[model samples]
Target: MSKQSIVLEPVRCPDCNQTHIVKHGKSAEGKQRYRCRNSECSRHNFILNYSYRAYLPEVQQQISDMAINGSGIRDTARVLKISQTTVMETLKKKTLH
Candidate 1:
């Protein structure tokens, strides 16, 4: 069998929809990390393989809405039953744009 490398699509910011991201390195958990080039972006680094509902646009929007509604991080995480890290990450990206 021939070994092949899968070329993953470049991830765009859900907030700004920009492709100006760079591979910053890897996370401590060994996940592929990316950095948004937009200075206005709040998240300096993001892991591509984040666990939970990070892939869903609806979930991302909810994260923002909840935050705007004065929802605490722990509260959102608990209500959504997702990791607090995921909630924090989602909100971080939203404020960037």
Candidate 2:
């Protein structure tokens, strides 16, 4: 019997959708991290899958949507099961961009 290596598609830069990625390091939780070579990319470093739900893009968008719908910081935090400070920080970053 022989072992075979599985081939996977190249990792892409989520922001730029570019395939020029290099391994940066491992996260504290042991997930692999990647860096994009695209100079125009804003978010350079990222993990393909994050262990924490709060760092997800969908969750961040939900936080913004809830805020736009007149939801309080505590309310959004409670609903998302994330820290109140995280909700505020996400909103701040969204407003800045």
Candidate 3:
């Protein structure tokens, strides 16, 4: 009987969409995190899977849109099924950008 070997591909940077990545370290929850080698990339480190809904791009955009539509922070959180704190933090980051 012959044994077949599986080849694993390296991870890519989500921000720059580049393959120049290296393992940085594990996250607080022990999840694997990677560092982008692309100097021009804005993101320094990221993980493949995010545990929080606030980390999602669509959720971030919704937080901004809800604020623009005059929705309350708690209302947005309820509609989005996320915490009110997440809604506030998302909007705060949007303003800084």
> Per-residue lDDT for 24 in model 1?
89
The segments of candidate 3 whose C-alpha lies over 4 angstroms from its true place after superposition are none
Give the top-scoring candidate (lDDT): 2
Candidate 2: residue 10 Cα off by (Å)? 1.1
Query: lDDT tens digits, residues 35-56, model 2?
Result: 9999999888999998889998
Deviation (Å) of 90 in candidate 2: 1.6
* TM-score rank order: 2, 3, 1
* Candidate 1, residue 8: lDDT: 83
Judged by lDDT relative to the true structure, which candidate is superior, 1 or 3? 3
- Which pairs of residues have clashing backbones in candidate 3? none
lDDT of 1 by residue, 20-62 (tens): 9888887667878888888887656666556546556677878
lDDT of candidate model 1 versus the reference: 0.77
- The positional error of residue 10 in candidate 1, measured at the CA in angstroms, is 2.7
Model 2 bad stretches (over 4 Å): 2-5
TM-score of 1: 0.49
For model 3, how does the per-residue alpha-carbon lDDT over 1-97 read when each residue is reduced to its tens digit?
9999999986878778999999999988898989999999988888888887677666788889889989999999899999998888778777733
